[model samples]
Target: MIEVTEKAATELKTLLEQEGKPELALRIFVAGVACSGVQYGLALDDEVKEDDVTMESNGIKLVMAKDIERSFSEGSIDYIEDENGKGFLIRNPSAGGGCGTCGGCH
Candidate 1:
């Protein structure tokens, strides 16, 4: 299952509050696959499709597409801060290099 860190959860809550969409769930999915690895996208969505997988973490609801669920199954989303800046990072141990069509990923 996907996990959300406390900091990430807090940030998500603040963003949702600012957007005035408290009912919206955080949607995460694989937007594309590249040579570096799979790219992830996130958004606040109020709609939940029939095939979507829903889970709650730190009191926040997360929705993901069923077809890409395995790509994020054991990953954790975290909010981090450093000298450079701050942003959300998805740490997925299963991710690997190369796009699926490149025949370079094994």
Candidate 2:
């Protein structure tokens, strides 16, 4: 199962409202592999194929490819804000990385 923080849910809702696509669900998937570990990508999608696993958290719908769901089975998506900027972050212990961060891994 996946989880979404309140902040992320609010931000996503705001984004959908601004984009005029509130019906779209958030989709997450394996974007690529980096030096640190597996990378993930997020987008507003309207399609949920048969190979996708869907879940709801914080009143927001989320979908991910079934084949890669194990990679984030118990992960949590949270919003982060600091001097460096702000964005959504996915944290999964099974992801196997130095910091579990998606920033530059150099």
Candidate 3:
């Protein structure tokens, strides 16, 4: 039940078009673990492993490994642009997470 914010969905679609990979799904994975909790990363992927969980958010396809799905079962993806710059971010309410950045670690 991961949700993609309107801004994030729009930006992701544009990126896919730019890369000529409009059909690729956004893949989410456990990049590492920090004091904030599990750190997740995103990428465009066409492959879905047997243990991968798939879903759609804001009309965008999303895929993640089964092991990491629970962490984001009720999360949302957002795009933020401010003084610090812009990037995608995953917001998981159930987890004590912070500082998961698409551009760089804060």
Tens-digit per-residue lDDT, 22-97, candidate 1: 8999899888768868889888899999999999988789899987787778888899999999999888888875
Candidate 3 lowest-lDDT run of ten: 97-106
- Ranked by lDDT from best down, the candidates are 3, 2, 1
RMSD values, in order shown: 3.4, 3.7, 4.9
Between candidates 1 and 2, the one scoring higher on lDDT is 2
Candidate 3: where is the Cα deviation over 4 Å?
A: 97-106
Please give the RMSD of candidate 2 to the true structure.
Answer: 3.7
User: lDDT by residue for model 2 over 1-106, one digit each (tens)?
Assistant: 8888999999999999999999999999888887677888898999999899999999899999987787788888898999999999988778765554766654
> Backbone clashes per model, in order?
0, 0, 0
Model 1 ranges with Cα > 4 A deviation: 97-106
lDDT of 3: 0.88
